[model samples]
Target: MSSSPLASATFWLLLMNTTWPSHVHNTAPTPRGCASRARGSPNSSCPRQRRSATSPDQFVPRKAASYYDLLGVKSDASADEIKNAFFDKSKKLHPDSNPSNPELHSQFVELNEAYRVLSKEPSRKEYDLKIQHSYQGRQAFGSTSGHTVYRSTTTNDNVHYWEQFRHAQSPEATAEERKQKKKRNFRLVIYCVITMVLSVGAHAVFFRKLEEVHNSFMDEKDRAITELYNEAKERARANGFKKQTEILRQKHADFQEKPEF
Candidate 1:
C-alpha cells in the first residue's frame, strides 16, 4: 500500500538516523560495536557531518542560563574552584582523551561545544540568553513538573557582580536596570521535570497545539499530499501493476485537475 507524505518523510528521517551513525545523538551511553558499519564510507576519516543550523521551535526562546551555569560553578566558588571543575571535566571527556569509547567521545564533543560557547565573553552572553530562553520554556510548566537535569552553577565572577550590584546605592542605578529589574524565576527547572514524566496525555496536549498551528500554516499543502496519495492508489488500480512510472504519471495528471471540493 502507498504511504502518506508525512509518513514517508518520517520514514526517511528514521532511515537516515539508522544509516548514519554519527547523525544520531544518544542522550546516554550506547554500545559502539560496529566499526566499518559505523563509518559507512570507504574513507572512514572523511568528515561526514556538516555544521547545520538547528531547527527553531515555535515559541521564542528565553534568556535562562547564567554564566555560573555555563562554567558549572557555584555563585560563591573561587576562581581556582571554577578552573579546577572546568579542567577536570574537560580532560575526562575530551575526544582525544577517550578515542576508543563512543560514549566518552560524544561527551567529549558536548563538553567542547559547551566550552566554546561559555569561554568567550560576548559569545557566552548570547549563549546564556539562549539557555535562559530554553529554561523559561521548561519553567513555564514547572508547578506540577518534576526536577530538570541540572548542573552545578555558582561562579566567583557572578558572585562578585551580584555583590557589587547589591552594594550600589539604589539612587544611582542604571536606566536599563530601572526598566527591567532582576528577579529570580525558576520555571525552567519545572519544565525539565515535566519532560521526564513521559506523560502521554501531556505530550498529546502539546502536540495538539502544534498540530493546530501546523494546520493553519500548511492546510493547502496537507490537502495536496492527501490528494496525491489517493490519486496514486487510483492509478495503481487503473494501470497494470507491473508499470510504476505509468501509474505515477497518471496519478500526477489526476492531481493537477481541479477538484470540486
Candidate 2:
C-alpha cells in the first residue's frame, strides 16, 4: 500500500530521535564524539557507566606477606618453635612433594629464607622488633571514621612492612654500646701508657750500660799506664845503674801523675 508523504516524514523523524545519545537530554557535559564512539556507545560516556566498564577482578590488588605470617608463626615464637614450624611448612611446600607444581618450589624458597632468619637468635630478635614497629606504624595510621589512612613508607608498599627494617635503639642496646665504647677507649689508653713506660725504661737501661762502658774504659787506661811505668823502672835496675834506676823511678812517678794516650 502507498503511504502519504506526511506519514513517511514523521516515521523518519521518530527513527532519528531514537538513535540520538542519552546524555544530550541530561544537563551534564557531553564527551567528544570519538571517545564516545570508541567506548562502543555514547551512553557509556557517563562517569557511572565508565566505572562499570571494567570487571571487578581487574581492580583486585595483590598483597605481600610478612615473614612471621608467611611461616605461620607468632612474633614471639622461640627458636625451637620457629624451627619446628619451618620444618612442618617446608615439608609440605617442598618441590619433591609437588613435582608437577613449579610454583611450590618458589613457595619453598620463601619458606627457607624465613627459616634462615628466624632460626638464629639475633636475627629472630631483630625480626621481632621490626614486626613490632610495623604493627605500631599500622596502628598509628589505621582507618578512622569512614576513611582508611595509610602510611606511605619508602619501601615496598605491598609488603605493608619495611623490607630492610631499620634497627631501633632500646635501653639495653644503648647501654651495651656505651660499655663497648668505654672499653675500647680504656684499652687504647692502657696501650699508650704501657708503650710510654716501656720506652722510658729502655732509655734508662741504655744510659746505664753506656756509663758502665765509660767507667770500664777509664779503669783499663789507668792500669795500662801503671804497668808501662813499672816495666821502665825494672829495665833501668837490670842494667846495674843505681842512679839511673832511681832517676827512672822518679820519671815514672812524674809520668804517672799525668799520662797522655
What TM-score goes with each of the models? Answer: 0.25, 0.39
In candidate 1, what are the lDDT values of residues 143-215, reduced to their tens digit?
Answer: 3432233233446334433443343212223334554453222456677667777687688899999999998
At residue 86, candidate 1 shows an lDDT of 60
| Cα lDDT of model 2 by residue, 6-63, tens digit | 9999999998878666667776665556443555555564454455648786785435
RMSD in angstroms, candidate 2? Answer: 13.9
* lDDT of candidate 1 at residue 133, scale 0 to 100: 74
- Report RMSD for candidate 1: 46.5
Candidate number achieving the greatest TM-score relative to the actual structure:
2
Candidate 2: misplaced stretches above 4 Å?
1-54, 58-63, 143-248, 253-261
Give me the candidate number with maximum lDDT. Answer: 2
